[model samples]
Target: MSTAVHDHPHGHDDHAHHPSGLARYLTTTNHKDIGTMYLWFSFAMFLTGGVMALVIRAELFQPGLQVVNPDFFNQMTTLHGLIMVFGAIMPAFVGFANWQIPMMIGAPDMAFPRLNNWSFWLLPPAALLLVTSLFVPGGAAAAGWTLYPPLTVQMGMGMDLAIFAVHILGMSSILGSINIITTLLNMRAPGMTLMKMPLFCWTWLITAYLLLAAMPVLAGAVTMILTDRHFGTHFFNPAGGGDPVLFQHIFWFFGHPEVYIIAIPAFGVISQVIPAFSRKPLFGYTSMVYATASIAILSFIVWAHHMYTTGMPVQAQLFFMYATSLIAVPTGVKVFNWVATMWKGSLSFETPMLFAIGFLFLFTIGGFTGLVLAIVPIDIQLHDTYYVVAHFHYVMVAGALFAAFAGVYFWIPKWTGRMYDETLGKWHFWLSFIFFNMAFFVQHFLGLAGMPRRIPDYALQFADFNMVSSIGAFGFGLAQLLFLYVVVKCIRSGEQAPAKAWEGADTLEWTHLPSPAPYHSFETPPMVK
Candidate 1:
């Protein structure tokens, strides 16, 4: 690899001057600025969702209703799921894509800069609609985040608000996906082939396509809910000759693919971080790409697994069960590849690597539980139980959130040109890792004991684990402040970082760019060979 810097024939001076302060963020089309906004906004939503989780935990701290009423409890559960999935996890990954994708592939910027800005700006308003709906005539949507028809139709104006929020979120996701797909397909450097691109870029390309395919199904489902509520439509009203189960079909069609949308990108982050820390080229790179694509394709077929209890025919149930369980094969390949990448290599326990290892360990637990749920009889027994809740948080929090933290720690040095306090970073990781398990792991036991989810209160037998889970939830919530502190402290006054922050980091961003990548990176695309 060469260590030379090349200037483009058309340079930064030809580009318009970027505005400073508020104007910079509000009017900028710069990918870095837009990426920063996406990150901050997602963190805000993470805190909001975390608070809702605490409220639910607080009410469930003891047997019998103690704090919120059942309706409000339902609202808390619904909003917590919606906000965390749409606002926090999805956008955080998009933020990473915006900041790293262009640099990784040696592109000047996202394919559509103004559309990128519009996509980010759409989020806050949608989030506001969701939060403010709690104050509306009947409170926020109490139907689970799935927004099933009958319960959704029974809700007040808040359901409408939630419906609209989903629409806006879908639009933003579609637009963002378009930008990512276009950028990856059209803007690589002179000689960088698709196979030569970093794993992170490859993951985002697949995720962007998943978003495009899935968001419309969600949008259509919500639109039907809206019509059933206001217009004289019976799309889901059984009394009006519509089947409520149809809503499940549509929602899961979008919902199941959504699981991979969140997890695959996290897989990408771990794929990058593990090899860098272990000082090895990624094991089975071609196979990893094929495995990721296979997972995405399989996602569409396996969605009916979520509907096993909705009473499909035995043959359909068996097919779904088998298809759902088969996802493990590719997912297993990814996990094995990461472990093999680190096997007997010169490994370091940097904060990033720690979180990658945590993602691997915890996400596998989530995956195994998913396999258990895929068995039709087992799902019939455990559907809508705390077991389901426990399973997803393991995947979402440990899988996506842990990987996001790893990406942040791994790349923040390059983003900010400063080293974060290693001591604080490690502390943040351990506290989060321990408390995250503490909070959700026990729910698996509670579910096996037959504790139902989405209820305000539970029977006495489930009391102890719920208490432990609540305490863990609070600890997990508070530990995030330490992450905030580390990010801020690094931005403000940490030691300066070098061009290639990690010795094993070999991508274009690390090898070809300076610390704190220039505002106009790849003003001229670098030669890849």
Candidate 2:
């Protein structure tokens, strides 16, 4: 009744191969395997999306169109955004949840294993639809990833496929959220009170709640798009008594929160890494949890910020501008807390900590630009331009992706019981850091100078910066092969690792369990006392 499964003994016969059928995954509820699947699938999607980015960069390497036309360029951006957000970043974090959460909480598995598996399996089909649409007649969706109507309405079969794919992916996210909330709420190990839980779990709990609330709204909005396309409703079409602006309102209602949904987990990952490498307890853990919750609450109200360019009245614009700015306060608190956690602590710059420090500086730069964009006046000039493009990529690629890689490197030893090559890791970090900045930093000037986003070609003045960015892009892309090598080498054969992989690390995970956890881990509950 307590939902604590510690010492739940079973004979060897209790272990049998789980049934292998489509139904096994369609209805799976296991946490570890589901988490593993999510992470690997996300890595694959990252590569796929990266390839799309490479195509974009290759075309832009010169002054004119080369690899793709404007239409195909549009498709590449749309699909790239979709895959990286839903397919890569989101799934990677969820995968981390599957592997780490139960272990941290001392639970045998997630609250609902079948639901866990179901959430992961649903993703493949959804991803397939989005990818395969490129080969379909009239090609994949070319309406920008936002799928802003009028343009979206003009799209062909690919739009329909993307719409359905969104629905499927949303369903998957909603289900995963439910499982995470249930597990955290119901399955904490004895003595692990809510306050005692790590920031990673706390941040995830708030994120899951946001997902539960916002994904449904996205599903509903896309449902309307589907109806408009096939069933003749005018929810987003102004010519038919509906408002195109209404579509943006509805989409951003979901879209704004979705940004935090991807980011908050990265914050959690950094929270874990900073403390581990800095040799101290996380500073202000309670405040961090409350701050995350506050961010989620604020996310819902700020949806209109993305819609300021859509001709909202002055009152709406002013209200949204101020409300969006409020987010900076809570975000500021989180940033301050991380630095404080590291203050005066004996720190070693491990691979994980290196990325965390990188995240701190880069994410702050990103947050500052976000505040700049939050102002109605600044946004009026910057919106829909490369400045906006530069801003979000700084946050997403530099902020989120960097933290994710840090988390992966920090935990790889525990997961595989082998230490990765540190020299190789250093190579991966420096190359990525320098080139990522090189690729994106100059774009701020281009955007300010009035270069628009999503264009396959640009004016002569923009040529030099675009060429530099493209070269940096290739450098960043090729550098990831180092990451792939490090992971594979560790998994295959590397230096043996200990149970408490890092000297400064303190968690329920380090207190118990061996490296390279057995295939059938936690069949009996782990004792937390």
Candidate 3:
């Protein structure tokens, strides 16, 4: 509504009156502070989940349940999936949105800043409930992260803890989503219309809506389980005249879109990194926007693809199979655009670009395997095997996690006002890339050999690959410590970075801001044109 840019002649130091120490984090509504907290919290959860994964890999190392009992092993698998998906990946992206979105769009802060604070604070207690559940009487929910009904109904008090945790996490997601959507829609600077905004902003706008729509479905699914367990309701009980298949329908309805909720933002990160490093404007910005929208829409109809082995009518199976495969079309458009952006441009291989490239190569492999799994016949074969496990890790680990690493490496200089050690950054990327492949690639073979997932012990024929995978898992986990070190070292004492750290970058945050962006950025709205 206002096309005027206010000037602050007194400069940054004159307006500094924010609180200090723990009180600042507890009681402030600053987007940057909340974002920093989100990033650190996500990293903590990532490490916690990584430890659980190592336990699973170690137990499966030689296939005898040597390290833990079968029951405990199941709990590790369940908790690892839940923490990584909800705690690690989702919050990490939200952190990036908090830090980057307002600045990118030239807004002073999120539209609902106090709600942003509340959204972030909600995560820790929910995460604590999840971690504490593992120690409660009878251990955490072990029916797997999908939390299917009948198995869920039979579990102990820990299951109740997990249900409550899900409710809290869902609330966090929904609130965060609403904040993001409101800020993007209402807070863009004058002259910066939606089409001219950066691709990252566009992706988050879509992702936030996806969260709003999908999280409620998850909340509903879990609530039914809570009622079935204690209130004698039969939402998923056959003897109570309900259908178990109904639970799968509802859970996967949320579950499948949940995959993109984690990934679409990753796509946004990669979209930004590729162009910044390539010294090019994005090749097809409009098409990229439309393709992302198409993928989100398609995510809803393809949920049943995860349930192919659960027995559906032939016609139902055919409809889902075709819908699932059709997703690749828009996904391919995105991939083609990334490669085209890099086509003969003056590309520099910075740490961020390295991770972005890794994301492209590995995420494509994941997508291809996904395409293979989309065929009803093939999915029926691979549904519960390690092949399914390998497929998603490629998508989630390489797709979301790798893109997150790219975003951090790309933007950390801005956040900290110092350059990271390139040597160590490269080391972190290469080690993670190598070990990641080592850990998951072999699982495809193990699955083809009929090695089942979620089991502590495997047949003797699966021994060698499992051991190799275990070694790789340990390596991948250790690589992340290098990442943590690099980030902290940068903050403490790395070289100073220029105001615009990357030469090829063109966004407003890069073009208009100083390094270590001021405590309050864009206190005066930036003119977009």
- After superposition, candidate 3 runs with Cα above 4 Å error: 4-15
The CA lDDT at 310 in model 3 is 85
Question: What's model 2's lDDT at 107?
Answer: 75
- Look at candidate 3 and give me any clashing residue pairs: none
Q: Write the per-residue lDDT of candidate 1 for residues 1-529, one digit (tens) a residue.
A: 3322354465332344788889899888999999999999999999999999999999988899889899999999999999999999999999999999999999888999999999999999999999999999999999889898789988899999999999999999999999999999988887888999899999999999999999999999999988898998999998999999999999999999999999999999999999999999999999999999999999999989988888789999989998998999999899999999999879999999999999999999999999999998988999989999999999999999999999999999999999999999999999999999999999999999999999898899999999999999999999999999999999999999999999889998899888888888887788888
Which candidate gets the maximum lDDT versus the true structure?
3
Candidate 3 lDDT by residue in tens digits, 120-189: 9999999999999998999999999999878899999999999999999999999999999999999998
* Model 1, backbone clash pairs (residues 3+ apart or across chains), number: 0
In Å, residue 328's CA in model 1 sits off its true spot by 0.7
Which rank order by lDDT, best down to worst?
3, 1, 2
What RMSD value applies to candidate 1?
Answer: 2.2
Q: For model 2, name the residue pairs that clash.
A: 6-525, 28-113, 28-114, 29-113, 29-114, 30-113
> Global lDDT for candidate 2?
0.87
Q: CA lDDT of each candidate?
A: 0.93, 0.87, 0.94
> How does each model score on TM-score?
0.98, 0.96, 0.99
Ranking by TM-score: 3, 1, 2
Residue 54 lDDT (model 2): 88
Pairs of colliding residues, candidate 1: none
